[model samples]
Target: MNHLLIATLLVCLSTTIRAATATPPPVPDVEIVLRETQPLTFPRGSRLPLYLWTPNFPTADDAELERVLKALEARGIALFARWGGNDFAKASAFPLRVARLQKKLGLETSVDATGLAHGFYNGTPATGHVDKDGKRFFDKSFFWSPGCPFAVQPRYDAMRARLEPWLEKYQDEQLRLDFWAADWEFDGPNEWNSGWASARQCVTCRAQIPNLDTDFAAFQTAVRKVRAEMQREVFVKPIQRRFPNARIGNYAMNPHDGRRYWWDFFEKRTDGLPAKAEHGALYRPWAREFEDCGYTVAMPVIYTWFNLHGEYPFANHQYRWFYNLLLEASSTGRHTTPAVPRVTFVHWTTTNPPKELPKDFEALTETSYEELLWHLLLRGHDTFAMWCPAPELAQEVRPVHRVYAAALEYKEFLDHGQPVLFDVPKQPGFVVSALQLGKKLLIRRTDFGPAPAFFELKLANGTTLRVPKVDGKCLLLTTP
Candidate 1:
């Protein structure tokens, strides 16, 4: 055989053997190139602002509040804080009667998560309600407000009296907020925290659903409508009755597609997940509740809770985990024309931290954490709303400020630009997503592993990106 032919035959044989093996080893020095497509577009005159919801700073002293507000203003935070007293006052901004530090610092303030759940949705002992049989409505869980359907209507009238003070206070235009979210999650007529069947075994609920004994589906359907009714009457009507233009929504209101992720991977067991019997089946079916309530903004959540991150196979990395949540938000949250503004509540801190993990687990470092924010913006989310713990404030806010600076640096692209490359490449190690407006293409790429990476990124418009090696950090670049 000729030397060239003999050499080619040996190379082909080696390649064939490698391909024939099961679960072939990862290729070294892999090159990944992704094309841009399916950008979340914005209509003319509408722009997504760079916003952050900071925990309330000291408002007791004029000088101290101004100093803190000025410091955050310098860091490019345009939004922060909620309002009210008791627990809600902890998040209150501009609460000082003599001081309005936000005006001085040019930071915007908003209200968040009013304690509706705290006030009315606790167990019957706490909520002070009884079933038609003169027994406490409490069941296996404290979130048992689904009983006595007739009792809920009468409770709403009483709620109006208590809610009046807050609404009256915000009537001051200077104190008014354009956004509001309710603290009604995990406390309504839902099956997650506890089943409503026990509570609904009453005169009123059974009267409405005469055959609830034989059919649980009727109870489930009726309770969802009851929850929707609660949202409209309890949260929306009361708040919107005061501020007609306000964008109103609540936490966990966005349809979650009936799946909850909690500590389990492709090759792991489900022993660590929260028990179904204790927490009930984690399911929130789409009920068109937001649409019925006329929600202006979709309040979907993309959290970095370590335990909640492990249920799916693709969630091997924090970056991948957050991206999946974002995918969930954008897919279900924006399934309409003139997409509802997704002012998503995102957190990078380890909420519900798992007790143990795979030995090779990668907690979100500085680069990976910041990448979460950038991906949210590039994935069509309108704002980055967060609450940093006071102790971890300095470290966590590093990513927030850095991402905010990029928002200012590329304001045009962020303001008017639609995000391209929303679909990520399926391969591991290399991840790329982008945004484009007209001729401007702003792409964000982060490769896994320690070594610096350089790769070619091809675009559908016949443009190719050749950038310097990104040393295991997020790379945000624009191409004209």
Candidate 2:
């Protein structure tokens, strides 16, 4: 590859680049492209894609949608609109309308699939309620299951069929599909729910995988193969027929380890995935296959409290694990991986409150918001999604939006990819990581604590510089 071509691809983050005099606050982090590993370009010069959900319920007024869009645009943000599946499945014309508005705002539109198993006569054999081992509970009336008698292949086929015309009409840059809903994932602890890979016992699924035992790994693999075929034959083909340039994606949830209270399934490691894939062993099924079949993956994590603990302990833990998994996935460098790791930060506020959060729990989450932003700034995320909670709690959740707005304003400068040179041999409590984008350098500082560290930066101008902040537990430096 030409140096320019190589620069465009495989942009690495490094720490030892020469710094220039402090100028314009570093160009806003979101617009900074420290590395260009692929031919990826940000629309409107934004780095991270900031998406907000425009749902059908508590229906957003045209004025509200326009207002939010303008706000996001002003802050260098983007939007992702959802079309109802259970309540508005194939009936509402919102997706098309939303797409038109998206085009007007120069925004990329994404459609969400709702009733895979919940709605009537659409597809799959799913009902609003599910029976796990003998106990039963209602699934949020969002998705219809592939196993529902009415769902089967035709039901899913219909979803794709409906999308074809619109996909052609819009030819938007990316598409997102949520084929499975929350009930499918194991709840960790004592919950035995299927987590998206549920319901293989259905007659049609059983007929296909006759010897399918109730093994989590096997069931996951079977579902993966089936879903991929559907995307390839039904969804992808139809979209390609209509618009060949668009990218398609969907959301998946991670399964919790038993110790953390998820319905335990794999006490030992499962099959098909590599041992190294253990960070998020439960959620990688489609992640691996989506890559094989060419699809984008979005993992939505629901941090709902089972018994209403004020601290949002579970949600906090889930967020950390999800972050780790995303970091692992990006570092692996596999394009075939179907999903780009992103977090759909959701807060179920109608019922639960943190027992011991800051007097203002919402404000405390702002710190989390900052941490999340810091992580994304370092890791290079594709998008940041926030889920819509119930109408009553919208006021409380508005702060998150504010924080997102503040973060995006700085995205362009944050993305410039500065270098943090590391002298591995001399550093005692630090480890070095680097990313180089085009002509820029990005170097991260990680201090393991207990001692001092030293590092050197090799700049583009043939000069060597040293990072001076190597004394603390966590140090971050940027090149000028």
Please tell me which predicted candidate would have the highest TM-score against the true structure.
1
Cα RMSD (Å) per model?
A: 18.1, 17.8
Mind giving the per-residue lDDT tens digits that candidate 2 earns over 175-280?
3322211112211111123332334434434454545454545555655554555555655566556555455554433212211221112322334332333233
Per-residue lDDT of model 1, residues 221-311, tens digit only:
6767777776677677877877888777666555444443332121122232233331222323334566666667776666665644444
Q: What TM-score should be assigned to candidate 2?
A: 0.53
**How many residue pairs collide in each prediction?**
1, 84
Native-structure RMSD, model 2 = 17.8
- Tell me how far the alpha carbon of residue 327 in candidate 2 is from the true structure, in angstroms, after superposition: 5.8
User: TM-score for model 1?
Assistant: 0.68
How high is the CA lDDT of each candidate model? Answer: 0.54, 0.39
| Candidate 2: regions farther than 4 A off | 1-48, 54-68, 85-98, 101-110, 113-151, 161-218, 253-287, 297-365, 388-434, 438-440, 443-480
